[model samples]
Target: MKNWIIIFIVSALVGFGAGYFIFQDKEEADGTNQTTTQEKESKQENVVKEESKDSNAPKTATTSDGGIFSEKGCISCHSVSALNIQGGATGPDLSKAYDNVEGKHGKPIKEFLKVPTSAVMSGVIEGNPLTDEEIEKIVEALKKAAEK
Candidate 1:
């Protein structure tokens, strides 16, 4: 009888200790989530203010970086922080992507941007092709960013 009681007490203590460890992480995660949400809200507010500054501005793509990229809709899927632009995460950052990246059809960045063989990019280019002037600017921008 005494041994059984000792075993039950030990088990209860172990269970309580395990429960404490598990529940503690959940509380920390909730706090972290709250902080993340607050950060996102703040960022959204800044974006709203920027947009409100130009109410008469043309509604372009998903992002408004106020450059050739935004005008050409590249900012919808790509961002070049080196060019001080913020865009969607659906595509890779083009900051230093001179020749380091490729297209779905195995073409380099320049070729891909010029022709856009990828199914997604094919449709995009079909709707709005990149002009030679715009392509020159983007390629030069990428080269400069990569050099840095």
Candidate 2:
């Protein structure tokens, strides 16, 4: 009886410790999630403010950082008309990319903006697919199109 009681006590202690650790980890994860959400919300607010400031401004065919598609040979796969340099249509029609990235298909605009070429192959042609600047410009262009 004494042995059984000691075993039961040990088991209860172990379970309690496990439960406490699990809940503690869960609380930490929840706090991290909250922090990330707040950061994203702040970033979105900034983007909205910038967009509103430029709403009345003319829609420049180029992003705030010039025409990256043309400069980076993206026009080979995509076309913006004015910056014509047509090539293969291996990729989807990018002219209407704004529609896809927006909530038109239930995808958050920010999520879509974060990864413009997510649908595209990770590596095509050469090893390097896209530079950070190129990706940023693409996201910016998408944002501009979404605003329109």
Candidate 3:
């Protein structure tokens, strides 16, 4: 009986220690999803750069239809933070969306945009179809977003 009691206590302590070790440095679980100080500063710099973009300046990757994504209501559910976009939390954050364009959706970006895999997106796309040019521009924007 004494040995069993000692063994149970040791097991409990080990389990507790192991749980703590696994989650000790997990910042994602700490709820640090808000914009960090570095990200804020980076945004400020980007704002300055945007302001200084003249016709002669080297062009940054941008969607040809500047507001097409929002105009067509993508921002209603999706967002691409790297594009300085924010949207409702109905869908995944598209910060690194281009990384898994094919693997996640089982199709290329252009095709996915034209024919969304998700039912929700399918409805959205049905209501607001994107032109070939618009899809091309959006793909460029996604590629640019992935670079960051």
Which predicted model would earn the best TM-score?
Answer: 3
Candidate 3 RMSD to the real structure:
11.1
Candidate 2, 91-115: lDDT as tens digits: 6545556566454545554444343
lDDT of 3 at 25: 38
Predictions in order: lDDT = 0.67, 0.52, 0.67
Sliding window of 10 residues with minimal summed lDDT for model 3: 58-67
lDDT of prediction 3: 0.67
Give the residue spans of candidate 1 off by over 4 A: 1-66, 102-105
Can you list the residue pairs that collide in candidate 2? none
On the 0 to 100 scale, the lDDT of residue 26 in model 2 is: 66
TM-score-best of 2 and 3: 3
Tens digits of lDDT, candidate 3, 1-148? 9999999999999999988777663443343647553564466446435744765653322345224555555654677777766555788877677778789889988899999997767866775679998787677777877888
Model 3 residue 84 distance off true place after TM-score fit, in angstroms: 1.9
Instruction: List the pairs of residues colliding in candidate 3.
Output: none
Residue 89 in candidate 1 has what lDDT? 79
The list of candidate 3 runs beyond 4 A from truth reads 1-66
Please report how far candidate 3 places residue 78 from its true position, in Å.
1.3
Backbone steric clashes in candidate 1, count: 0
On a 0 to 100 scale, what is the lDDT of residue 114 in model 2? 41
